[model samples]
Structures are given as C-alpha cells and as structure tokens.
Target: MKEKSNRLLSLSAIGLVILFLIAARFLTTAESVRQSFWALVPPIVAITLALITKEVYSSLFLGIVTGGLLYSGYSFEGTLNHVFVDGVISVLSDRWNVGILCFLVTLGAMVQLMNRAGGSAAFGKWAGKHIRTRAGAQIATILLGCLIFIDDYFNCLTVGSVMRSVTDQHRISRAKLAYLIDATAAPVCIIAPISSWAAAVSGFVEGENGMSLFLQTIPFNFYAVFTIAMMLFLVAFRLDYGPMALHERNAVEKEDLFTTEERAGDESLERPLRQKPGEVIDMLVPILSLVLCCVVGMIYTGDFFSGESFIDAFAASNASTGLVLGSFVSLVITLAFYMLRNVLSFNQCMDCLPEGFRQMVPAILILTFAWSLKAMTDSLGAKEYVAAAVKSSATGVLSLLPFLIFLIAVGLAFATGTSWGTFGILIPIVVAVFQGTNHVMLIMSMSACMAGAVCGDHCSPISDTTIMSSAGAECVHLNHVYTQLPYVLTAAAVSALAYLLSGVLAVSGITDNPFVSLFGGLAVLGLVLLGIRGGAGTKAE
Candidate 1:
C-alpha cells in the first residue's frame, strides 16, 4: 500500500513538472528563458519520480518521453524526425558522446579481463592483507578514487570494480561506495589542472578570447575547490549522511546489508594462492604503464614542455584510443606472462575478452541515450534558450551575478547532463556580464558556471556520472541516485551560500579581489567544518 502510494505520488509530481515545463514554454518564446525553465523541469521531475517509485528504467524512460513530448510540441514533423532519425544518429556520431561511450565499453572490457586474470581479486587480496580496519579500507578506496581524476566515468567504474571486494570485506554498503565514487569523479575533475574539463574549458574560452580566459577563471571556481576539499574532509573525518550514515552505523554494529553471493568476493581474498611468481608483477606493470602513458599524454596535450606542439599531444591522448590501446597492450602482456609461466591457457584469455565486453552493455546503452538526449536538446536550441532566460532574469540583480551564474549553470547542466555544454553556454555570457565589473566579479562568475555545472550534474539523476556511479558500484541505479541526492544538495546549499557571500563582499569592495574572496570563502568553510565536527563529536560522546 505504501509503495503504491509512493508511486502515485511520484507520478503526480512528474505530471506537475511536465505541466510546468509546458507552461514555461508557452510563457516565453525567447530562447533562453524557454530553454532555462524547460531544462530545470525534466531532471527534477525524473529524480523525484525515481526516488518515489524506486524504478530506474521507468524514471529514465519517462524523462525520454517528456523530452520527446517537448520536442514534438514544437512541431509534430520535427518530433517524428528527431525520434526516428536524429536521436539515434546524434548519439552514435557525436565526437564527445562517442568518446564517452567508447571509454565505457573499454573500461567494462578491461575490468572483465582483470577479473578473469585474477588481477582484481589479486589487488583485493593485497589490500586485505594490509588494511584490516574498516575505516582504513574506506579511506584507501576514497584516496584511490581521488587519484583517478582523468575522467569521471573511468574513475567511477575503475575504482568501484577494483575496490568492491575490499569494501565489502569491511562491511561498507555499495550505496556508500557509489557515493564516494560520484563525489570524487566531478570534484576531482573540476580541480585537476590537466584533465578533460581543463581541455574542454580551455577550448571554449580559446574560441572566445583565447587561452587567457582559462587563466582568469581558475581562481574563482570555488565550488570545485571546496567540493574536493569537502570530499577529503568527509573521508578523513568519517562524515556520512542520512541513509549513508545509517549504513555506516550498521557497519559499526557488524550488520550485513549485502547478500552472501555479494560477499563472495570478500571470501576470494582468503584463498588467493594460485598465481605464478610474476602474475602480480604482470598485472602491476601494465597498470603502471597505462598511468605513465596517460600522464605523458596529458602533458603532451598541455604542451607544457618547451617547443612541444600541444595540439598533436592533445590529439594523442584520445581517451578512448588510449584506454583501448592500453587495455589491449595489458591483455597481451598478461597473456604472454601467463603463457610462458604456464599459468593460463590461450582459450581462457580469449574467452574473457568477450565476457568483458558483454558486461559493458548496460553502460553503453545508458551512454547512448544520454548522448542522444544531449544532441537532441542542443540541436533544438534548448541550451541557448536557458542561458538567455537566466541572463535576463538575473540582470536586475547584477550584484548577485556570481551566485546567479552558479544557479543558472547548475540548472543548465542538470537539464542537459553535460558540464561542457553548460560551460560553453555560460562562459561567454558571464564574461560579457562582467565586462566592466571588477575582474574578481568575472572570475567569480566563471567559477560559478564551472561549479554550478558540476553541482547540477552531481545531483541530477540523469547525469552520466550518476548513471556511471551506479554501474560502477553495482548499486541499483535509482537507489544510488536517491541515496546521494541529499548529500549533494547539502553541499550545494553550502556552496551557494558561499557564492552569494562572496558576491556581496566583492560588490561592496570588502573583498575586492579574487584571492581575497577565495580566502574569505575558505575561512567561512572552515568555520562551518568546525561546527560540523563539533556536532559530530557531541553526538559521538
């Protein structure tokens, strides 16, 4: 009865959201306002419905239907065209979307290979041998998740796969693992000086005013900075929230939330004595080589070394190509090392490759749909409409530019599920908005866009990271989405408040510079952290 009631409530909420979006569309023909308001509706409705109904497929399908309805409302013929041809083709052909899809496929393949070769089990064995405490295991997982900042999808799946056994051994919930992966992916990507984000942002800004724009916006991207800090702090201090907190409490009480089959991986840690002398080295070497190649590739892309053409290097790091090549190379190395040592038969390795690819089917599907959605919206001018609406609405409160930009960016990214799209739409507008304002204000606006996009993406159930995080942790997609939303919203609220304060201070000349605003925000964060810690300690006592 309760479940039925929840589902009905969710359906009602979704209907209301759709109605609101339709009304908003009717209210404005101005591209920006229409896009912005419409953009806000889908994700909020999708997430709320998913949470209430606890159904992933239903939630996603409803979003797609809503999007299609919106597209159709504009024109019946256009809607048919998009649904039949454009949606499918756009997902398959777009460069950015394809890159992510390829990565997901390759990652799934690699993880399967690792499992087949006992590499994943081997790593878990090694970690279990060293890290005995539950807290220690969780910390290690978080740190490793943080270290893999090149791509959020990669970070989520890779970290979750490699560490799942160890985390389960420690009685940590899969939900919690998903949270850690999701938290680290965007936060780390946002701050990593040399990452996909840096490349994307650099490209957007360069197209507008060249490389100098990248330099100008770095200091003010406070949400990213503070988000990463918050993740680290949560790890160090053992902070958890709501369901996550309940899971941690259960762990402390040695209660089991996972099934016996789920805990089977942990048992593997106890019986891993069958590999050859060089098997471990075979696994470690390939992973190390891949890391080295990626690092060199990133540097080459950055053209940081003197006289180096960054364009060539950047082209070379093709994340999909790199991962594919690296994984193939690793497979070859593992095969040869195992063959010479007589550890495994040729048939076994060959068999594992197909299985690996098969595991990635779900991720591939989700990615395709996500890409299609992004392409459809982009082609329809949804992003442009949203950006214009946001700019116009916030024009009167110019002093609140930084905070407004942050909210707008979040809204845009949440709707589109693409930070790159959000940034591309907002960077120019933000730059223009702050044209004669203090340079600090410009920096803050830029930061707000970057930060807001991340925050929105982090919270949006439809966001790729959210989906990937579910895939990574093997948590039910909607469960992961629902469990993590509250935590992300809390962080966003704090970040929003920080941005507003920074804006107010900047306009009043209290903090006339970016450095001052950043430091002031950090100081305020510190006080908040102190209160959080004090409260936690009191509860503990």
Candidate 2:
C-alpha cells in the first residue's frame, strides 16, 4: 500500500511538471528555440525525475543534464564543456557565488564539529531531561530554530540536524521537523538584520535610494513577520496541516514515518540530563562571541566606526571577510575550551578538523551546481526577458504594481530556485518604475517582491535551503517536498491577498493611514485561519 501510494505520488508530480512546461511554452515571449527550450525543459525534467526516483543524486544529475542540454543544444561535446568546464569555473570565480559556497562549507564544518563534540547530544539530553511534555518539546524546537538567525542555510541544516534526535525521541514526525526548519529559514532571513540576506537586500535597496529603503519596506514585509508568527502559533496550539497533521498523529502512536540510521557513537542521550552549570555557558560563549565579532567586523570593514553611512558599511561587509573571520575565531575558542577541560586532546581535535572538512563535501558540491545553474541562466539573458515581459504587459496598471511584482517575483523564484536571482532581476525594474511616483508605493512593491521571492523559494524543492532541510532531517527528499507544499501554499495564498490589499490601499492614498492596510491584512489572515480550521475539522470528521 505504501509503495503504491509512493508510485501514485510520483506520477502526479510528473503530471504537474508536464503542465508547467506547457504553460511556460505558451507564456514565454522568447522566440528562440534555445531560450524557450531551456526555460521550459530543465525544471520539468529535474522535478519529474526527482519525484519518480526519490533520489537526491539522481534529481541533481538530471537537473544538471537538463541545464547542459539547454546551454549546448544537442551536441554532446558542447554540453560537456558548458556543464563541466564553464559551469564549475564560473561558480568558483564569482564573488557572491563564492561567498555562498564558503558559507555552506563553513556551516557544514560547524555542524560536524558540534556533532563530534557531542554538543547536539548534550542538547538532546538536556531537552529530554527537562521537557516532559510533547508541547514543551515542540516549543523548544521552534525556539531553537528561531534563535539561529545567522543564515537561513545555516539555520535550516544545523537546527534540523541538532534537534532531530530530540524531536524524534519525543515522538515528533520528520515532516514536522522539516516544517520547523523550513518555517525558520526564509522567515528568519527576511527579518535578520545581520545576515547574508541582509547584505543582499541592502544592496537592492541601496541601489534604489538608501537607508530609507530599508525603513519603508519593513512594515509591509507581512509574509516574513506573519510566517514566523504562524510557526510559533502552530507550535503553541500543536496545529498541523494536511499530511503533516496525520504524521503528528502517527508519531503519537510511536509509528516511525521513515527509517533513520542510529549513529554509533551516542544512543543513550535520549534520556536527557542537566548540563553542569558551566557547560551551557561554555557552549553559548563561543556562539555569542562569534556573533559579536561578526557585527564588529562588519562595522570595521564597512568603516561604520569611521563615520561611514549605513549603506556604505553594508557594502564593505559584502566581502564575507567578517563571516569567515568570525567563524575561525569561534572555532578556535571552542577548541581551546575543549583542550582546557581535557575533553579532547590537541591531536584528537586536529583529527576531527579533517572529518569536519570532509562532511562539507556534499554541501560544497550542491552549492557549486546551484551557482552554476544561476550563472548559466543569467548568461542566457533570462532575467532581461522576464523583465521585458513584465514591463511590456503591465504598462499603466500602476496600482497593481505591488501584486504584479509579487506574482512575477514568486514565479521567477520558483522557476529558478533562487530568491537572490529573483530579487536581483525585479528590484531594479520596480525601482525604475517608481522613480517619479510615490516612494511609499515603491517601498511596498519592493517589499512585496522580497516576500514573494521568499515564499516561492521556501516552496521550491530544488532550492538549496529546502534540500538542506530535507538532508538535515534525514527524510526522503521528495517526501519532504510533497509534505511541505501544502503549508507553503497556504501561507502563500494569505500573502498574496495581503499584497493585493497593500497595493490597493497604497495606491488609493490610504497607506499613510496605518489602520486601513493593517485591518485589511488582518481580515485576510482571519479568513485564512478560518479556512484552515474548517478544512482540518472537515478532514477529521
């Protein structure tokens, strides 16, 4: 029965991909065979194979093959060179891409180190010791995820990996684990002031005006704030959606949703225990120091202490030196503490470092390929074509700009599996459109784009953060994708309604009156919550 269900799911996913391809072919204005083929075929092929095989490597390989075919047409030799030589080189050399790769490598290394040091085990032990109720356990997972706002990729993978044992021990499903990680990733990134996302968002805003851009957009970033709230609310109420709700019930019955390998080193930590007084401090000190140093380093690099503007300070930190330096310092301090306590010998620490590096290999590979795909798509002028289509079609519907931008941003992000690329393409266009109009509208439109990109990327299974979350939870990758889609779509539907109201209110000159938009957004959210409750109740009945 399970095998049949899996087969049926795979077939349905394939059908969806086929439908998307058909839609893209009909909608795209690009007349070139190459442009049309690449845009339509790659994602379809990748997703189809992924759903059918339920294998990460197979999905990734097919994605690469589809991309290569788009780039080099039918020639095997041409495809090989484009996919291997140019793709790899381009990803390695580009600064932003390099930063992403470096961050992933460092994150993987950090997770491995934490695992080796038994930090996660210690955490699981502590949680199981204190958190006697299922509600407490779920709340702990959500709070821990919220705390790790340094980077979405870092948060998703690390939080899920660290909390998985605890959650599973407490009878939480893998689907819920994926949901917690997914909920935190984009929601936190959108709100975090000091992250790679902040740098990217700041760049887009600065390119338009300056610090005012950040200030104006913050209030309208409803999805970011609302999503986080929803996650917390769900945890507080023990609410679940669709298949996720069923998984929760199964977990209560102690039925495993999927097989997980038990690590050989530590199986007894599930019993939980209080850390010695100084032990928690020892773990926290390095983490806090790392964060402080990152902030100070960013200020120093950006020359903020020397009286540079906010934008300039942000631009300076774009080098990623701050993150790299901060991570190294944290690693050294953590090792020193272990050495001082005789927890590990210097030789053992040195040996562990190599293992840490080895663990990052998969992340490095995936990041390299993801970056390569971004580069190849950019080189093909895909962004320009998308920009052109939007500009041509939405000429005078200025009031609809925010909703339109949101739709376009979401569509592009979903297709490309990249929020950064979507923002890079749309922000400039929106900025230009609002150059002579109301700055408030401009801010709302840009905010909509950011929120929409995050929404789409959060849902896209091919997204690096999404894939990492699945990997972290040790769940079947496609299962994670399918399970989370409904929740994401629910949030997205509310978000779209919010964007539409924001646009209408902003354009009608009532935006300055906060209550109008605020009440309007609240009304939509109320309806969404009612719908969710009704649907769940109906299903239960």
Tell me, what's the RMSD of every candidate? 4.4, 4.6
Task: Count steric clashes of candidate 1.
Answer: 5
lDDT by residue for model 1 over 396-423, one digit each (tens)? 7757877888888887787777787788
lDDT of 1 at 270: 23
**lDDT of candidates 1 onward, in order:** 0.66, 0.66
lDDT per residue for candidate 2 within 1-541, as digits (tens), equals 9879977886776576556545654554333544343553565466557657675455665566556655655467977887777776866887766665665556555555555555666666777889877667777777887887756765776677667768877887777788778888877777666556766776775446444575567677777766776665566445667767666776776566553332211223222122432244434554565566655655566778799875567655653666666566667777787678765567766765655556555556656666666655664567777878777755778778778888888777876778888888888887877766777777888888898899888877677787777656756556677777777777677777777777777677766553455556656665666667667721211
Candidate closest to the true structure, highest TM-score: 2
Q: Which stretches of candidate 1 lie over 4 Å from their true place?
A: 1-36, 39-45, 74-80, 207-212, 251-283, 295-341, 393-396, 435-437, 513-541
Q: Looking at candidate 2, what is the lDDT of residue 504?
A: 76
Minimal lDDT window, size 10, model 2: 263-272
- Clashing residue pairs, backbone N/CA/C < 3 A, model 1: 31-385, 32-385, 32-389, 33-389, 36-386
Worst 10 residues of 1 by lDDT: 259-268
